[model samples]
Target: MGTVKVLVDDLLYYNKKDWNAKVGKAKKDNVLTVVSKIKVKSAYIYELISGMYITAATKFLKFTSK
Candidate 1:
């Protein structure tokens, strides 16, 4: 699995892939394990290990391969 680091404070988390619902927040500098990735239109979304969803925006996240 890969990893993603939150680049912005209080980044929003979604409970679903559509990103229509807000579930929780992840703080800046938080490193999350990425279980999978999906593309929604022009943006990418990551499914975390904890089953939370976050945007893969470069301005808000930094991705790394492991």
Candidate 2:
């Protein structure tokens, strides 16, 4: 899954009900949410031999999952 941060118009009333109401209105209007910024994070795993099972798993997922 991926995530993005966006900026939205300020609520006329800074209350839970008002905020939810504005959000529902925006959704119904198909308002586009602008992504102001993005941050990505990843991890690297290293294995010397990658094991038979690991290699087989990769192959199966790559070739047969479609």
In terms of TM-score, the best-performing candidate is 1
Tens digits of per-residue lDDT for model 2 on 2-54? 11121222212111212222222111112122212122123211111211011
Model 1 sits at a Cα RMSD from the real structure of 1.0
Model 1: lDDT to the true structure: 0.91
Give the per-residue lDDT of model 1 (tens digit) for 1-66: 699999988999999887787988999999999999899777899999998889988899999989
Give lDDT: candidate 1, residue 56. 88
Worst 10 residues of 1 by lDDT: 15-24
Candidate 1 backbone overlaps, count: 0
Candidate 2 similarity to native, TM-score: 0.14
Off-target runs (Cα >4 Å) in candidate 2 are: 1-24, 29-33, 37-66
